[model samples]
Target: MATPADLPDSVYLEIFSYLSVRDRIRSSRVCRRWKRLVDDRRLWRHVDLTLYTMRPKVLWHLLRRYMASRLHSLRMGGYLLSGSQAPQLSPALLRALGQKCPNLTRLCLHVANLTMVPITSLPCTLRTLELHSCEISMAWLLREQDPTVLPQLECIVLDRVPAFRDEHLQGLTRFQALRSLVLGGTYRVTETGLESSLQELNYLQRLEVLGCTLSADSTLRSVSRHLRGVRKIRLTVGGLSAPGLAALERMPVLESLCLQGPLVTPEMPSPEEIVSSCLTMPKLRVLEVQGLGWEGQEAERVLCNGLPHCSVIVRPCPKVSMDWWM
Candidate 1:
């Protein structure tokens, strides 16, 4: 019988693949051979430090040790302590990351402060970028030179990022390859910004605009007119209008529609009107109405009865607490 130490490096690597990052790190301390196997570039392809709260310097040190050219995705979370300042991401650390991880494609930062960092500091190879409750500088996005913008970015998620505004929306039009976009808790975005952005993002397939002050003019008219190719859309806005509902019927490819937020108003459309609009949509498969009060359940019943093939969901709006940002 062969001893465990007799196992080949490939065998050790295969075993390491099944272990979590922390477990892999612990395994490295077993022996020199295991340490070397753990350091292999393949094992570091996707690094997630979302649960760890460390200083920027400490994170940089770890990245320098394990990060390799094979690294593609990185997820990090900043410390959100009460009355204590969170660790700031330094420009030097990002520059080094870009240089070391040339193939890095996905970058997710939660509760981070990127106010001092410029857009150019991010890896150019990134295809998916997510920033949740982050303080990103608006000027950082606008100031980037035309040549160095994230050219390959396909998906972007900005949730509860109070720093992002209308100008940032206009600036994001440069990313012509964008496919999926999620904007949540970004209250400042208005009809003008969204309309202009929608017109530019021709390739966008999925769009979610939550916690924004919008009405039929923004969600219905502009989106239906410009985003005819969009397959899925989630909008949190004010009461619906007749012309707006009519405009929504223009989308030839809409498969999923989610109307969220405190949408019950005096101008709110009736269950019959909404059900009539859904009947006209040939491709619509999923219809969800949240925060529409009593009408939501009524519409759900009507939708299920009318469109037997479609899925209908009705629910109250979720309450957002101030602590959620932290």
Candidate 2:
């Protein structure tokens, strides 16, 4: 009887997928059959090496040889490519992966530092790209490349990263079919990228530009005109004023609004003012304004006097208390 290690390359790869990376790497050493199966580029569709804190050279070796054009998703540990000792993922490697893994759907990079190898041609079917604490350039983020390369690309989430410093929304025009996008901590996005990003949201239903700056006329006007598909908006501002709430008027379908900021004097709407102003929104079911605990006292009163038709839900410092108001 043929042992598991003695199976044909095709048959062994099926079982190989079930084995852990450490086990698979071990099994790759057993015999020629297992080695060939492990080396077979098709067997390595998803490369996630969170446990292997090995050298970048090892990671580079795996990506360079094993990952095929059909490779779909890639998740990696933190990468620190600097100094004299270690180098990050090479541009050649990235371009190779970009060429070979034309079917890549998701990429999650979790590291303190990384070398940004901007990909010119991404997989047409790529979706759900995530990066953490990596130093990527603006042109890379805002590349107006061919959409045929990334036709189905959508859902980009960045955390504590600086990819938006230069590019902002320049690259967003390429993703014509984008449905959901979260731009957290890409503060480099000034008014230029802000306007560019917002104006081209033909299919953007849920957009979260969390930490990008939009404190200018161009921003408010562009947002008012283009981001009219505003259903869920979370804004963290220096101060919240009547004019800010007035922006909600533009978002006719806005159901939830969260305004948060850190200042000695709270700058959020009083529960009364919020209920009164947002009374026109009969569909407005949820409104959260943190640090505005002062509003809790007069919330019901303002609702009864001003906008008596809709539910006036108000909570201040609820986030701190972890409160979920009824």
Candidate 3:
């Protein structure tokens, strides 16, 4: 017999927390009390505006009002399609955000333009930065700036960033706290670049490289010798090579490995060869092979035979989904 308005402020805020940003905006119109409860900063701690299309001013206003000193994680931006100028985070807005949200630790930007913002202007508290399909000069990040600007930064994910080249790796060495790195769909990085840069990452524990050439014997050998502390690795192997497999055996602390892309090629090692090589990896526990066709089962069986203590998982790659924006 009690109306929804009869719920306490705490209950109303909890309910608002469960609603999406759009739905929460609608609920705010219910009443003054509801509006105030919906505006609570706790609900805006993890803001995700990736699906929304709004002007820069609107986003800035929202951040100033709701996210100041409250936001911890933020994901923004959308696909930059042809003939459409979408709203983007500008340099001034980024500087304001850094000034307002000093506690923000994680940030992900997709298809956003950060070419104008200086890396030193970013929040110093950030620990993780993911930039997917974005336009930003790597030189800004690599330039000689105060190391204290991003002292806590540890994890960096650069996916499909055309501007990210092998030279950028030299800049990353400046981040002494870096621990995890993912370089996917970066065509410019060759085996030589990876070998040269990886030696400086003494503290790196997790590494992933996809769609880049890594078939050379010397490349894998260098990886084995320098990255002795790596615990997890993911690679896109179009054709499995003996030297690549040998590198896996050298990582004494390696626990999880994901090998994706084509498993069988004319020049690749045989299933038996792969299985035999894996036996040298004593501490490996999880092995995942993806993007295989009908031959996945056979590969899984052979891998399991050699690494009896490790769990092997094989699955076909999923179809790519397309998204269209109006």
Specify the highest-TM-score model's number. Answer: 3
Q: Could you give the candidate ranking by TM-score, starting with the highest?
A: 3, 1, 2
**Which should have the higher lDDT, number 1 or number 3?**
1
Over 212-290, each residue of candidate 3 has an lDDT whose tens digit, in order, gives: 6555344456668788888887777664677667766747888887776663566566667766766777778888776
Per-prediction TM-score to the true structure, in the order listed:
0.81, 0.64, 0.87
**Weakest ten-residue segment in model 2 by summed lDDT:** 317-326
The CA lDDT of each predicted structure is: 0.78, 0.60, 0.74
> In terms of TM-score, how similar is model 3 to the real structure?
0.87
The candidate scoring highest on lDDT is 1
User: Tens digits of per-residue lDDT for model 1 on 243-319?
Assistant: 57777874789999887758556666666777778788889999887777755455568767877778888878768
In candidate 3, stretches whose alpha carbon ends up further than 4 angstroms from where it belongs are 1-18, 78-87, 216-219, 294-296, 318-326
lDDT per residue, candidate 2, 164-273, as tens digits? Answer: 55354667667776766666666777766666667677456555544455552244455567876666655555445556566566366766665544332344556556
Selected candidate, larger TM-score, 1 vs 3 = 3
The CA lDDT at 200 in model 2 is 70
What is the lDDT, from 0 to 100, of the residue 292 in candidate 1? 72
Which is superior by lDDT, 1 or 2? 1
